[model samples]
Target: MSLGTRPAANAAERADNGAMVLPGRSHLRAQRAVKIGSLAFLILALSAATLLLGRYTVTIPDFFHIVAGADIPGASFIVMENRIPRVLIGILVGGAFGAAGAVFQTMLRNPLASPDIIGISYGASASAVFAIAFLGASGLALSGFAMAGALAVALAIYVISRRGSVAGYRLILVGIGFSAVLQAVVSFLLTRTDINVATDALAWLNGSLNSSNWDRVTVLSMALAVLAPAVVVLSRPLRGLELGDDAAAGLGVNVERSRLALIVTGVLLAAVATAAAGPVAFIAFLSGPIARRLLGGYRPLGTAALVGMVIVLAGDFAGANLIPGVSLPVGVITGVLGAPFLLWLLATANRSGQGG
Candidate 1:
């Protein structure tokens, strides 16, 4: 009605549109800092606990020296020879799976689109099992099989996901179907193999750290050292993806290209992890949500990965020592712990009329 009212309206509109640097940024940074600190401390703590909590325990000072390259009769050997490699492998592989799972879920816009459910881990498991049983392979050769198998599984999932068009629901449904087929192949291969070979395959399938040596650590460390940096570089595009496909593309996000790149990155990360740790179970599926809850926030791939490393190492160690009679496989332990959460998710989905 009046010129003064027009100016006030315009000013109000501008204020709403303006970037005033919300307090959330500082909070996010604080969360980032906290997560980073937690990761570092957790790594140290897990390493120390792994070394010191064994049958032949060591004191704090002796454990420190043992890690710092001093010689103690049994302490040095255990720390250097046994604990360090295992801890390192757990951290690297766990982090990769967590990060990969986070990125994949964000891209697919579905919390259930993780590698474990979508046949990626099954792919690697099938391939690695075959290699171990048939070729009598161990060590680094198994790593190659795992990586190839995981990537192949990823490719198959992608093709199926893209069968008609790129619908999130369709991709997830197809992925479930693919996982069934992969599991059957894995089962058949184990049945046909020799007993000893089957034993080896079974050990790998269970995802134990009992056999984790320096060689496996070396393979995973190298993969993670490279892949982590790539993830950081792609963070911008990945963040854009959380806004949904249409919005992301409208922001010049190169939707298809970004999705493809992220999927490739995620598949490689999971494959490398599988190669190193044999699909240690639930880390990929559970890490992101757990990390989100821990931070009291949402998905941040790097933070999620760090949280993943902590969860896996902690779970693995706990499983080994927490119960005396059963030194369970890390995979079995995690699966047991994560089953309730998975059930909760299923119940929530059904209540919402969302198909599994």
Candidate 2:
């Protein structure tokens, strides 16, 4: 009788503990849901503002009418040709950068492992500049060169860092070195080009959305449609990978294969986005950390994507309208915003003894 009662009491205690724990878990889930919803709402609000509150002031009714195919002349041309493409490309590019950055940071277990910091963006920039100055490449051809550059740099970094396994710090150090060299190459190319060509290349290097078009929108949309799903599928293995290679292998993950896939996917994501937007300055670096903070240190890729979209849209809006008579490039605005954040991150890392 005593033994039976003791077993029953143990079961009751276990149930009570579970019941006590569940509420906290439920509360955290609820909070994350709220944060995600808030981010979605913010994106919508920004999109609406970008569309409706520009130089021409598109009314809500006119906006709906334009969407419904009611051709309103000036409004239609501006909305359809300029504003809509810019918003669409910004969202797609930002989401791609954010997802890529989160994957790198999470997979490598290092905040400094963003594509931009590690020479991938510089690689694309250098290639695009070379294409412009020497190959006379433009449009899709320029984009292709940029993509090839990012992939090549990523492969080189991986190969150099892969001694036994790629350590995050070693890869980051190698990438930084590559970035310096590529940056110098870009500078040399710009100096050697004709003044007119240099002017055009400089504009692109600054990452403006003034030339956003439907073609860019279509290409980026298609790329993301394919890559986003792949990222989603690989995210499970990515989470396992965060637990270290041996541990992930213990859990039946093909550590090397999974890591390779992730690197390629992340590189491609950053590549496509750079191809579309000229490496829009720090969207990749900033999105992951921002999302992690918002979600209480839990890194959800979707949330990071949303955060990236917000950053780009907001930056573009500010750049276009902030100085009244002068329009700044989106990259300029983002760089200004990101520089302080970068400094803060480095300082915090140093204080925490993670600076190395």
Candidate 3:
């Protein structure tokens, strides 16, 4: 073949390859959309069911009427004041935990970097336990203590891990160490406290929606309103950082600044959620990975949030009714569900020599 003909043929071949790649990309995007839509539908269905199906079942018509401001005797108070707040707080706190987990896992590029696995949740739990046992804090004051504790732990982790740049392995190691110490602190406090206070603290630590109320819902809503936007904005820099610090810097990202912002934002998200509903077990640790799997390894923060809501709402329902006579904490159900997955993940990682 002539040289000129060869060049034209190669150009045609490149065009054909590009055409093939476009369709694959488009197909993947369509699949992702479908998966995300399905997740949203599941969340809605779970929320509705949670509201309707319980010891005192409310009919659909009655639920709508109650929502429409009708006073339908017992149903009105049960649906409006009790069930509604529980559902709302579940959704809000679940989303917060999911988003926080996604940020930590993605930013650090480590699956074990979850707030609960590290010291953040332990921090919140320990602080709140201390407040309950000694200071006799309750309501908003207890929540405030939780938030402060999470932030303090996060700050300490950052300072300890920051040498030149924050290494993911170093951060995770430091956090795990902190987690052990804080867990010990929590246990000691529970032992030293009065039995009544210890019982209350234990319930909170187990993560229940039993105390869900309009006040808790409102606080969580306000915190997410401010923090969610920060997460969206920082996500761009987060993506860059995923490509490594030098590469992100080359891409015009302020690596240290962006990382710090992300850390603070993630800590606050996890903190508020823990404050509102306690550290509801593996929701944060599990949500991101679940969403990513559904999206074929593409992590969408929003999808993670929705998956979190579904897990919480569904878990809460099952926890309440799974045993005929006894209601369990939502965290207990989640812990049971998530433990197997965690073991599977560890096994898979070990087989691939990534468990270290």
Give TM-scores for every candidate, taking all chains together and pairing residue i with residue i. Answer: 0.90, 0.97, 0.97
List, residue by residue over 6-44, the lDDT tens digit for candidate 3: 989999999999999999999999999888899889889
Measured with C-alpha atoms, the lDDT of residue 92 in candidate 2 is 91
What lDDT would each prediction earn against the true structure? Answer: 0.82, 0.92, 0.92
User: Which 10 residues in a row give candidate 1 its minimum summed lDDT?
Assistant: 16-25
Which prediction has more favorable lDDT, 1 or 3? Answer: 3
The whole-model C-alpha lDDT of candidate 2 against the native structure comes to 0.92
Q: Which residue pairs of candidate 2 clash?
A: none
| Candidate 1 lDDT by residue in tens digits, 1-356 | 79879999998877776645555677777876787797879877887788778667788899788767789997787777787788888888888989998988877877798998888889999999989888877788988998898888787777767843477777788778988999999999999988988888988998877788887887778887888888777767876777877788788998877788788899889998888878888888898877777777666787788877887888888888888766777888888877888889889889999865
Clash list (residue pairs), candidate 1: none
Candidates in descending lDDT order: 2, 3, 1
Candidate 2: tens digits of C-alpha lDDT, residues 1-356: 58769989999999999999999999999999999999889889988899998677999999999989999989999999999999999899889999999999999888889999999999999999999999899999999999999999999999998988887788999999999999999999999999999998999999878889999999989999999999998888987888888888899999878888999999999999999989899998999999999999999889999999999999999998899888898999999998899999999999999844
CA shift of 238, model 1, Å: 2.2
